[model samples]
Target: MTETIAPTPNTLPARSIAPWLKFTLELGPLLLFFFANSRPKLFAPLVHPFLPAKLLEGESAGLFTATAVLMVAVLVALIVSYAITRRLPIMPLVTAILVVIFGGLTFYFQDPSFIKMKPTILYACFGLALLGGLVFNKPLLPVVLDNTMSLTETGWRILTLRWGVCFLFLAVLNEVIWRTMSTDHWVLFKFPGTMILIFIFTFSQVPLIMKHELRGDAAAKAPEHL
Candidate 1:
């Protein structure tokens, strides 16, 4: 599968997504993924009569099954996003591509490692992209976040640094978790646990954003000022 690089966050000029709708579009697939993994036996039978017997007769069949379902769910979510806004989001689109690739490998080879490694790949890509942008003195956080909130250059730099570091940290965390713990634990961490950490980190940044808040006409100020 070919992976498409997502547009910088908040950079896409398009219709606004309602907070609830955006959340549903993003998290729905993940929730389905967690359910499939956690209840593979239940899921296996549900899909059993439909799939060929040869595909579901192995020690790792449950995980393979879950991975397959997860792939479908991801595709569905992406389609829904496009139907709603008439535009495909960068991050989710990139993620769906990875899911198809790794998830396909998992189903084909009957190995769970490929699917397990998807998050690590995604996090590393995002983290490196942000940090690399900073190295070139081009803050790309605005690309992703410009529409959500306004921030001065300093604010963008700080937020970018934090998110960059966080993504890298999550990459390491995923590696450690999947390698050391059960799949169920990893699935839990994948959603709410990761969500909580991100929310907290984001919450901590409100003060910085406020401190650097641009007043009236500041955003429209001369390009040189920017």
Candidate 2:
């Protein structure tokens, strides 16, 4: 019997993914993967049986293997970055750790809910960590966001407070999706919904941030007389 594999969809880039779209595109492989593997009856005579039916309620044939491949690819990317730059990466490693924890659970239990629940767990953990930092008089946001946005200690404090709250809100949203909505609806909204919420929330603070922003070269360069 001949075996056939579906072509990779053009959802996410093979090498790297943008921060915003990463949530959506990265899941593509899984959605394609499960759909292809889940109902062997659907593929029938066209595809081989090596791809068994889902192991659990939503198990995809070799679901574990598919998830592993995606995660390993991310690990490789990190390794390559270290080799080129010779610096320990924090965010990528954090992301990789999350991938391992969530993806591993999905595979181990053969439960689709594990995958669905990953975001809630991640957001909750992050929110708690940020709030903890506030208690310690530290702003965790600067740790994650300093490269992109630099601000004074006071700014960091406010930013951390805001992000901590946002993350908590996201956690609640995820819970609602998983508990009330269908798995498909939750999956569909996970990416776009998060992107919109985050984008809006993030930018909404810009005006306040600008108001509190300490003067920089732009301000200094203004006409002294004016």
Candidate 3:
């Protein structure tokens, strides 16, 4: 039998959202984006707030169906995430909530622009929240990643800053891609490609984090368990 070697000082699990689960969670938004972009009104009825219930009951069947599907998918993803993690994560939970709201708006207003602008909304929210955290001398990354890595407060600060910047970059990239590239390219990039990019970026920062590593309970538990 071959011995399997794990990554040295692997800060986190290789799988973030798991395989099939991740696909189910992320794929919904992509499909909604494409459908809405192509059909334009594919999600308008179920997306809006002030629209009468009969609005979906009367006109725009296609848009209603698409928005309904999108809502179900978002709910499923959120449920799965909460189930697995035993608590909601900051980013994905926020993503889910925004997807519902924006997706609803896209369907309700019969305007593709609202849904198209989803990335900008997400990016701006996270950017502001992170920057706010920094201003208060509080780094939120560790709270989300606390179970995964052992690092000092300064390490957390550095990591959060890098990620905050990366998220901002993603926001810009999303704008450029959606504006320039085909919808297919944007969706494909959003899924596995984004995950890979984040992994690589996070790994590159491992050394910097390790430099400020703390001997926490995860360290303390190692020998005791052994």
Candidate 4:
């Protein structure tokens, strides 16, 4: 007779978002950013009512406009996520903090590089945190993911390593792109391109997760009830 484990839950603890809400919350800010950066003049009037006149003018208008809008949008997203879930997802919170800091610096210095480098810094931090946790015999993915995934310790370790390496790779990639590519191109890559890559990478691990899923005592005990 063959034995089988019950399918593990894909939903993360305190991190579940309804598909529609998740799409809106995650993509809304990025879309706004792209539009603001690409068509600053068009967005300027809409945002100008809220922004200082100093930020609405000069050669830095596009970048500044986008950065300001991005910051506000992220804050709103975080609030909405918390309102809906009653908990904040760690990665997005971390990303939001970086956006605020770098976004503020970008405005203060009037240099777009600070905002451009936000992703590189964010990815590097995540990569380092994941890898560092493993070195101490702790897998941080479950914590970061807040998911109800049931994996063996070994499975968790492997997934952590995979994600750690992927994040570092993304960090390097962001650096390369922002340094060599145009601002508009980088903005596109930052939001849409990076989001697609992450979605693909996440789904790619489903097979591995299923293979190593651990059946809890409750699952084993359930057979007695039958």
Candidate 5:
């Protein structure tokens, strides 16, 4: 009798949430972050009941308030996601961990610098992780992306490389923006700016994805031997 091998996490099909819901979960917190920072007075009352009184005062008040809101919103999003899917997606889970840690530090130290550095650290870690996977002969972009599309190994390699580079570039860009620009400007760039860039980059890769995409007959036959 032949033994059957179990599928690994990478090979398992993703339990995907609705596209709209996923978008809301991801972008909602960001928009709230911007809103809270821009209008801290609005969120202050809501969050004041939970956070330290000292963290919500003075010039950094808006930023600190936004950080608190962001931390809570991210946790809520994760909880909603897990409740719906019964499993947390890896990328969001990692992001939430970083948000809580960095946001906590920003609140505790009463400094906005930590929150400003979160994006740089998050993107850098993602970029390095993808590159590291390539070095180990493992294409990890699909894993991070939840294997939404099927592609040839070569395609995965190329796509992974592109995303890895893009992530690193975004990391550098975040550092530049936060270090040189005002907090408000940085928030603006972090939201619509980063979203626009990612959308453009993603659309630009459509041709590459189509070129290497596994299709009807090929897809059906590719795994027959297995």
Candidate 6:
């Protein structure tokens, strides 16, 4: 008699959500935040019944409203991702956690600065975490990238180091932008501007990824021990 083995998390089907859909899920919240911030008055009524009374009644109301919308949008995106993939990516999960914490603080204290600091904190934590992983010989970029491609240990190390530094750079950039620019400008930079920079950086890494890419037997034997 043949024994039927049940699938565990590690052995589960690999049919995750499409890349486009995943990208949309990640970008949707940021776009919503940008839109909500740009036209808070239009979105105020939609979120008014749900947010605290005080959050909608100040000079910072636009930011407050945008924060609330951002929080909700991020949660919704996570839910959709889970529904489709049966798992959440580590980076987005961490991002959602920061959004909730910082967003809550922003609402509770009626301060927009908390929300402004969220990106800085998120990027710095990711940067540190990635760099920290390398200290122990663990390449965590795979986890963040959801193990999309296979690479040699040397390749992983180089890629991970580059990403860690890039993330730190982005963290510093966020601080500078938010501190020096107007709220509207900051919001614009936060979404498309940030997204653009990441895309450019990612494309710039293509040659490195291609050069170090594992193939055939080598790819098959690539470690999953990130």
Q: Which structure among the candidates has the greatest lDDT?
A: 6
- Model 5 per-residue lDDT tens digits across residues 47-80: 9988788778877788899998999999999999
Over 4 Å off in model 5, which ranges? 1-15, 220-226
| TM-score of each model, paired residue for residue | 0.83, 0.65, 0.64, 0.83, 0.89, 0.93
Candidate 2 local lDDT, 150-206, one digit each (tens): 455677678888898899999999989888986556655664577678889989999
Error of 5 at 214 (Å): 0.3
| Candidate 1 local Cα displacement, residue 104, angstroms | 1.1
How many clashes in each structure?
A: 3, 1, 8, 2, 0, 0
Each candidate: RMSD = 7.3, 12.6, 10.0, 8.1, 4.2, 2.0
Report every candidate's CA lDDT: 0.79, 0.62, 0.65, 0.85, 0.88, 0.89
lDDT of 6 by residue, 15-101 (tens): 678889988999999988988887888998989998877777767778888898989999999989887777777989999999999
Measured on C-alpha atoms, candidate 4 has an lDDT of 0.85
> Which candidate's TM-score is highest?
6
lDDT of 3 by residue, 146-223 (tens): 345666667777877888888888788878877887555665566556667878997999789879776767555532
Ranking by lDDT: 6, 5, 4, 1, 3, 2
> Residue-wise lDDT of candidate 1 within 1-226, one digit each (tens)?
9997787755554566788988887888877777777677778877787556766765556566777787888899898887767677778888999999998787677678888899999999989988998998887777665345566888778888988999999999999999998877877888778888889988988888899877668866613311
Could you tell me the lDDT of residue 147 within candidate 2? 38
Q: How many residue pairs of model 5 clash at the backbone? A: 0
RMSD of 2: 12.6
